[model samples]
Each structure stands twice: as structure tokens, then as C-alpha cells.
Target: MKIPPHRYPSPLGRCQPEIMDVETTKRDGWQEQHILVVSGDDSRLDFVEREFIRRLGNRLYGGKRHE
Candidate 1:
């Protein structure tokens, strides 16, 4: 899944610090699946989220870059 970067406001209507939550779940006798939740300032989260997506994509697709 691809997540577009977006800002999340606090209860007071102010932008809050960002948090990226990554969860991996495995069902019985099944392969594990991943879920990623991204919340925060769009600018800040964009870079981080893009990096994560790039790395994951590379790994999954057997790209040359790995770091």
C-alpha cells in the first residue's frame, strides 16, 4: 500500500509531531503482512515515508540498492 503524506492536527487544531506506525501481522499458516500508519506534518513525513517506501520496494523487487 502507498500512503500519501498529510498533516494531522491535534485537538487544539495545531499540527502535532509526526508518528509512523508499522505493524506486521501473521496469520496461522500464512505469510506475514505489513501495515503502515503515517501521521504528522506533510513535509516532514513525506521524506521519511518516501525513504521507507523506497527501501521496501527495492527489497521486495530485488533492486540493487540496499542500505
Candidate 2:
């Protein structure tokens, strides 16, 4: 769910809305260690992280060495 700058939703409920600013380069993007934020009604960030590990395995997260 990608939101464009010019097309942000107006307002809703008790939650205060503010735009999150981030600087990114094409080479080093989401694959690198960085602060990411999920801005929606659900906790998709947790879901994404879990899915990434599930697909890629523990090495991505540096779990341990199997002997």
C-alpha cells in the first residue's frame, strides 16, 4: 500500500496524522538496516518482517550457526 505525497488522506478518528520523511537511494533501499514505519490501521510491519524471515531463513536475521 503505497501512498503518494499529493494524495494523502484528509483525516480520521482520534489518531493525529503526520507525514514521515525518509531519504533513500536506489542501491541501498529497504534491504539495508534502517528505520521503517507502517502507517495504516494494522501492524503490517510485523507481518512483513516475519514473512521475510520465513522466506529467506534465519541467516537474514543472523540467528545462529548450525553445526
After the best TM-score superposition of candidate 2, give how far the Cα of residue 49 lies from its true spot, in angstroms.
Answer: 0.4
Per-residue accuracy of model 1 over 1-67 as CA lDDT, tens digit each: 9898897856875566556433332232134334443333335457778777667766766676557
All candidates: TM-score: 0.28, 0.19
Tens digits of per-residue lDDT for model 2, 1-67:
9786696665664487565545444224555755343332335457776666455554445555689
Instruction: Tell me the alpha-carbon RMSD of every candidate.
Output: 17.8, 15.2
Q: What is the alpha-carbon lDDT for the whole of candidate 1?
A: 0.54
Q: Best by lDDT, which number?
A: 1
lDDT comparing candidate 2 with the true structure: 0.52
